[model samples]
Each structure stands twice: as structure tokens, then as C-alpha cells.
Target: GAGVSQTPSNKVTEKGKYVELRCDPISGHTALYWYRQSLGQGPEFLIYFQGTGAADDSGLPNDRFFAVRPEGSVSTLKIQRTERGDSAVYLCASSSLGLAGGSQETQYFGPGTRLLVL
Candidate 1:
């Protein structure tokens, strides 16, 4: 009955440090997504996972970013060598099914984890 939820509502770290953001999606949802939102802009897709493997990872900006959904229910976004430019709100969303043939599915978003690189 619970909805999507993210941990550490906020995070502060220095550049070059590593951080792991966690996301717990709604139970039974088959599709999960990770996104990043910068100032004055909407959330940008980073990755999508259907089950245990990453279905789409094209949105990943660089090799420093990676995500995994090991068991298909919980996911973790790992950032290696954090940068000042990466300071933004990291969001997680889940849906019953990912976009199928141009049809849309309602995605429930968690209160993003606001990361600040200081």
C-alpha cells in the first residue's frame, strides 16, 4: 500500500566524493526510473529498469553515474566522483508498466533527494 519513497531527503557532500541514493518503489510495480532535476528545469531521465536489469540507460550523462535494481523492488543510484555540476534533486519514479507503444502510464514520484556538492 505504500508509495514510492527515497532516503536521506537531503544530502551534502564535497566534490569528488561518492554517494549512493536509495529508492524504494511501490510494491509490484514492474518499471522503475531515475531522474535528475536541475534548477529551473524539469526532471531529466537518467535510467530505467524493468525487473532486475537496466532496460534503458541512455540518459546517463557520463560513466560516473550508474544504477542497479538487483531484486526488482529497490534500486540504488551510485555516483562516482561527484561534481558541483551534479548538485540537483535526484528523483525516483515507478509505474505499473513503462511506456508501451506510445501509451502512457501514471508514474508516482518520491520526494527527491536533494544533493548539494559543497
Candidate 2:
């Protein structure tokens, strides 16, 4: 599809557990990003991918978070040793091109995956 979609709309996990969130971006998109949003805060960028390579990953909180895109299409965000504070909405977005001219390009966001860690 030419639109973004995420699997497992909701996830509940205990502390120290592991979780994987998936994101499927538009068919030909070359730029992909993952963000996390707290209860009332806006999404904070976690990672960015250009094609299948991670263009930027400095936004990830720590080593427990990771993301991958094998074919430059579908991406997955993996979290290890989940903590209660990790509970939030995981958002995925894709755009036709990278952030070349700032926020002028069209970026499509998927309905986020709600993760609750206890």
C-alpha cells in the first residue's frame, strides 16, 4: 500500500520483557522515521532511515531500543527490558524524500502503536 500501517495497535508488557513494534511504510518511500510520544507530549524522534540504512539513530533513548529496515519498506522497532516509563505511543512515518528542505515534503504517519510497560 502507499500508506503507512502498524501492527498490534496495543501492547502490554511487564518490566524486563521484550517487545517488537512493526511499521509498514508507503511502497516507494525512501525516508522512514520512528518516534515515541508520552502521554501529553509530542512524538520524539527515535530513528531515521534512508533506504534500508539507518541515516540517524541518535534519538534513541539508550541501547535497549533498536530499529531495522531490511528491504527499505517494512521496519520494526525492538525494545528490550521494558520499563514502565517506556509506555507510550510508538509512531512511524515515511516520506517521499529525506528532510532536504525542512518540513515541506509530504510525510505520512501511521496510527501509532500504544505500548504499556508495567
Which candidate leads the pack in TM-score? Answer: 1
* Model 1 stretches with alpha carbons more than 4 Å out: 98-103
TM-scores for candidates 1 onward, in order: 0.95, 0.93
Predicted structure 2, TM vs. truth: 0.93
lDDT of 1 by residue, 1-118 (tens): 9989999899999999999999999999888999999999999999999889999999999999999999999999999999999999999999887456211888999999999998
Worst 10 residues of 1 by lDDT: 97-106
Best candidate, lDDT-wise?
A: 1
In model 1, residue pairs whose N, Cα or C atoms come closer than 3 Å (at least 3 residues apart or on different chains), thus clashing, are none
- Which tens-of-lDDT digit does each residue in 1-118 have in candidate 2? 5579998899999999999999999888888999999988989999999889999999999999999999999999999999999999999999886457444678799999999998
Per-residue lDDT of 60 in model 1? 100
Q: After superposition, how far is residue 77 of candidate 1 from its true place, in Å?
A: 0.2
